[model samples]
Every structure is written in C-alpha cells, then in structure tokens.
Target: MNAILRGVRVIDPLGRLDAPGQDVWIDGGKILAIYHHIDAAGVPVVDLTPPDGVDPCVLCPGFIDLHVHLRQPGDDEAETLETGARAAAAGGFTHMVAMANTTPPIDTPERVAEARLAASNLPVSILQVAALTRGLDGEELVDIRKCVESGAVALGDDGRNSVSPRQLAIALAETAHLSRAVFVHPEDEEMIAQANGTQGSVTRSPIRPVETETRAVNLAVRALSHARSGHLHLQHLSSEGSVASLRRARHQGLAVSAEVTPHHLSMWLPVAEEPDPQALRKVNPPLRGELDRVALVQALREGLIEAVATDHAPHRAAEKSLAYDDAAPGMIGLETALATCITIGGMGGEWLATLVERLTVGPHRILGPASGVPEPRLRIGESATCTLFDPNAEWTVGETPLHSRSRNTPLIGARLRGTVLLTLAGGRVIHQDPARVPIVSEQVTSV
Candidate 1:
C-alpha cells in the first residue's frame, strides 16, 4: 500500500484543493506528503501522468455512498458483502452506508454487529443502518439505542415507508436524542393505493405517479418539522414537487436532507417504445418525466439535494426477468454512479466540484460523528483513502466487466465518459484498472 502517486491532480473540495501535477506519498496507511515532488527511498511509484493528448487523472477524497443495499444473510444469489464491497471500490467509494432492509432485516444489535464484522476486512467500510421499525413492517419501533451502541451508523426502513407521518415523527424524535439520522423511503403506499382507487384526483397511470413522491416528501418534511429534532434524510427523491418541498423545508431550517438516485436524475419513464419485460430501469420512487429529471439535476445543483446515492439494490437475473410488476424495484449502481453524474447529468467545472462535494463532504456532514467513520481527505497525515478517475475516458457500460454480481443498470448499452482508474482504502490498493494504471517496475521511475 505504500507508494507514490505521481503527477495526479488532487481535488479535495472540503480542503479547497484543486492542484494538478502533484505527487502524493502514502506510507503506513497515512498520507506521508503531497507536494510537487516526493523523493522517497524505498517505496515504489505509480506514474499517474496522463499521456500527452489525454487529460490528467483526478484524485480526490474517497467517495461515500449514503445509501446502498448489500443483501447479505439473505439474498446471496444477487449480491454478497464481498461483491458489494468490490462494486463500491470499483465505483471509487471507500465507505458505504448499507441499508437495513435485508432478508431478516438489520433490526437488532446482534445483526448490526454481525454486519460490521462481515465487512471488517472488505475494501470498503460498511456503515450498517438499523431498521427504524422491526422487520420494516412499520408497526413497532426497533430499540434505537442498542442498535447504535452495536455500531449501527443510522436508522432507516428504506425499502418501505414509515406507515404514517406521525409514526415517522416519533421515530425521528427518538433518533434525534441519539444524534442519528432516520433515512426514510418517503413513498406513501397508502396514498398511492388511495389514488389508484380513485379517479381524476391523481394520475391514473399503471406506473406509480409523481404525486406519490410529492405527497410522501411533504409528509416526511412535516414529520421532521414536528419532531423539531433528528436529521430526516429522504431517500431517492424524484419529481419537481419533491424538490419544491425540500426547498421549503431547508429554507425553514427543518434539519431535513434528501438524496436523488443516478437513474432518477438521468433517465425518465417510457424510455422505450414498447414495454420492458425485464424491468431493468424499474425502481421504487420510479423514474418520472423528463421534466422531473431536469428538476432533479437543478435541485442537486441548487443544493436542495445533498447526496447522490446508488441505492445499489442487486437482484438475480430470474428476479429481474419477472413480469414488470413482479420484478425487483432497483438497479445496480455502485459501479456507475460517478460516471452517470458526469456524463448523463452533464456536470463540469465548478458544478463537477460541487458534485464531488456531495459524494464526499455532504454525506459526512449528514451522517456526522455518530456514524463511527472518519472523513476522508487527501492531506498530509490523513488516511490514504482516495480515488483516481479519468473524466474523459469514454466506454460503454456492459462492454466493460463490472465487479458487481448483478447487471440491472439501464445504462448497460449506453456510453459513459468517466471511469475509475484506481481506488485506495485505508492505504490499501483495493481496485485498479490494470490496463490503464498498472503498477510495475518499468513504470516506477524515481524522482
């Protein structure tokens, strides 16, 4: 793990650093130094200097995913802790907040400890979230204090809503005292069912309507406002209504935050002329109209949305190949999140820097110290947990080999511009694109 990254552009948004042609020295799992040149005696070097015509690779604090589904102690045919960690590392993420809505549901202290132990040796750090309610049934609350004491970073019932705004308020109030966040799915199933039962009051499409997201956002925000405590993080926010609600909540200082998925920000409904039997693009808080997509991008730009999580729910091919309504409601995004934001969301310059901040700084701020994780930075003495990526590397999705076990991304056939070149977690080389940034004796010329 001890090596030199030569001529890499360092961009730590939190540190206000954006300097190119810098050499970062890593020794003993800590950043030894970062300067124009580092003359080390025994440590090897990896030349990160781009070719004459290519843009230099960018290095930044390791990415943190606020929300991801690593189905362990459950659905192993789709994704395990090993595969999910690999995918997160491949996507340049050093830390991932794994959701609690698993097979048995991470609702107890023992389960939380088990999950933490499972990911202890993985490349990426897994911050386990305890379910807000037992079995995620939304009927009874889980023991919040015990779970947090057992290493649960946050509390959430992500796969389903909290049943009612009042119930969510109660949970939030409890978590507020604990200094932990309650990540809500923010989709009102009751409202959707009612809307479907009625006519003309709501969109009667077979697919879930935008009103579902909007109403749920309003309810969740109201719950936060009522609780007047705890951080309420809305997951996978879609629709312009949700944006307006988030704007008002933040304006009123409600201590609530929200995240948007890559697919929701990039794609829209009815992408194909015919029905998709495999339901590749189908996701809970499903994709909306093009207008919704545009609004989501603008919301993230305006800081209404704090993070861009993968919601990396993986499923087996058989589960994904079921009928549209019966298929799973997520896509594997750990390997494609950054590229999607850059290419599909069209982020660049200051905006691109802002996006990186969301991936690193914003999540850390929301999770706070209770998450039991340190903030990643590329500075002297900081842990050498960082990512290197080529923003101009264009390649198709499915054409490349993904580390994840599942392949449910809608962008499978599309071209993406950015690609991760290397990833370091705890000073260990977790993932490196061998063909692009191989470390060999010939390439390691000392200064």
Candidate 2:
C-alpha cells in the first residue's frame, strides 16, 4: 500500500535521519521520498505522531536477527515458517537468518532450496544457515561451497557443542575459501557433561558449565587463528569469560563477532532450579551467574558483543513441561527480545535509538557480504525496509501473540514499556497491531 509516514522520528544512521518530525513516502517497495511534509495527495497517511498524552514513535531500519530457528520442515509443532515470520514481523524484524538444525537438518543444496521455498512467502526475509557439518554430526564438514551458493546465508553447528576442535578447525579452514561465516554454539561437551545438571557440584542431571563456554570460546579463537579468511561468529555467548575472550580477540584484530541472546541479558543461572513448566530456561550453554549477566550487558554497551540475536528457539509446551534437564532448551524471543533488552537489559530511551542500530546495522554486519537486502541509505530510492514502534507505549507481555506458534517466552506476565506498532518489508505492511492504542492522524487514517 502506498503510504506517507508523517511526523515520525526517522532514526537512521545512513541518511542522518535521526531528527524527528519528518515525513516518509513509501511506494512500489521503495522509499519514494523522504522530507518534511504535512500532506501528500493520492496516498494513505500513517500518523506515527502520538495522540495527546501518548508517547511518540519512530521509523527505523527493520530489525535483522543474525540467529533464529524457525523449526520448519521438521518441528512444526514447535514452530513453522508462517508463525515464525509473523512473530518476527511482530517483533519489528524484517530480515532474519534461520538456523539449519532442523528435522533432517538443512545440509545439502536441495535441503537449503526447500527451506528457502518454505520461507519465500513469509513477510520476513528468512535466510537459511546450512549445517556446518553433515547432519550437524560435527564429524565431517558439509559442502561449504555448495551450501553458500544454494541459499545458505551462513553455516553453523548449533544445538550442541559436541564438535571436535580438530574437525572444526578443518571446517573453518575450508570455510575461509568460501568467504562466509561460521557460527559456533560456544561450549565444550566434556566440561558441560561434567557439570552434571549443576554448575557448583550438588548435581542432579548434567547441565552446562561456565568453563564449557570459556573453553569453547578459546578453542574457537584458536581455530580461527588458523584461518586467513571467512568470519568467525560466536552464537549466544553466556558468560563473562566468553565475553572477555571475544573482546580480547577483537583487540587482537581477528575477523570475529559474537551475539548475546535476550534471555541471557535478562535471566540468571539456577535455571535447573526453576519449575518444570518454565524449564525452557534450560539452554545449551545455560544461563550464567549474576556477574556473567552484568558482564554481558557491559559487553553489549561497549560493543564487544556485535549483535543481540534472539536465538529464538521454540519448543512444545509439553516438551518444556518435562523435567528441567530433560526439557527442550530456548524460549521464543523474536517477540520479546526488544522489550527484554529495553527493560531487562537496562536500555531505556537514552539508549533506545542506538539499540535499533544494534538490531539492524549490527546484525547486518554479522550477515556481512551474504545478505540479500542492500545496506540502507535512508534516502529516496532505497528499499522501504523499516520498522515502526511507540517507544513509550506500555503493555503487558501477553497482549499480542507476536505471531509465534509457541508460547514459551518467560516474560509472559511482565509489563513492558515499548510496543512495536508496524513492520514494513519493502514498502509493504507486513504486520500491524489491530488494537493499536489509537493515534490521532492529522488528515489521513491510520492503517
């Protein structure tokens, strides 16, 4: 739909549209024009300006998540492409990279193509991350060249840290030639198994240990040291030791980047101690100590962690209802990551606009040369790939589905300050809140 977004704060780093009270014209999947205007003929107008006493909103580059699992072609009961896409749009994401740890595991060209087809119709642009090793067995590398050419944005071996350092070094060396990225699920298997459902030794079942993540981070750093090409991306970093390692690596001039999940920014350890119903807290790396959470937040602020990825893992309620250690790990985050980051991560309005950049440009950098969406110019003739939200609008977590098939988020009853109002991908209205607290438009009606 052709529309004019009026008087909204356009917080774009590219166009220097950080100034508020501007107008944006979107048509034909591109930004037709951007200017200061009160009216335009023959087009609909979206008054992003708040009504009297309502908080103001802003338009920004739609969020780009570097890591997420859509659980399609396999775990539809957990989540499907449709629900995942809706969830992403609802979360203000227009582009996201889907992890390859699926039912059959997106390993081959054919599997990547099939995953692409499944995501093709979604409102969000979903890129597949083909398995780094065959079946994610971590024993042998998949066709790294073929996977990238076949539509995989990047390659990874997530869901477990069972990969051999020698094999992974071989994989990284091979991936260097492809000039893509390798996202490792940062953890050491032996150390974690040794933790045995408890970090401090009063063990019940096997759980992840902080040393496991630190060891994996060190190993990944060493492996990347052997590679002269390709990027090394760390996924869902969970500890202060992990952050310290990545930070030092960046200082040493390595082509490495890391991500922190929303949950890590919010929740602390003693995850296994939580009740079974909320057992989704049982993540692979597991939540860390309070010091770890503080360090992670500091890393985000200091730009040590390059992006905030949802790690948007979804699982069946029944699966999560199982015993804590026996339950599936990961809660849905595409819907709650932003709010969690804003509130739980302690990013208020002072850091608000910058967070949008971390969600958009930061992840864009993580995607690197493989992204299909051109970098934004925040000007006329650019693709109208952006998101809109009311920064001051308050709502309870359960007010909207955010379109996820799963209801596994831990923030269900928590109240949040900001709300995503609309999400546009290529000038099309992909998602909007029907029960949006009414906005007072000047001349045209709101969508």
C-alpha root-mean-square deviation, each candidate: 4.2, 4.2
Best by lDDT: 1
For each candidate, give its TM-score against the true structure: 0.91, 0.90
What is the Cα-based TM-score of model 1? 0.91
Candidate 2: which pairs clash? 196-205, 196-206, 197-205, 197-206, 197-207
Per-residue lDDT of candidate 1, residues 90-153 (tens digit):
8999999999988899999999998889888777888899998898878888888999999988
lDDT for every model?
A: 0.81, 0.77
Q: Write the per-residue lDDT of candidate 2 for residues 94-197, one digit (tens) a residue.
A: 88899988889998988998889877877688988989888776777888888878888888978765667777777777777776778898877667656663
C-alpha lDDT of candidate 1 relative to the true structure: 0.81
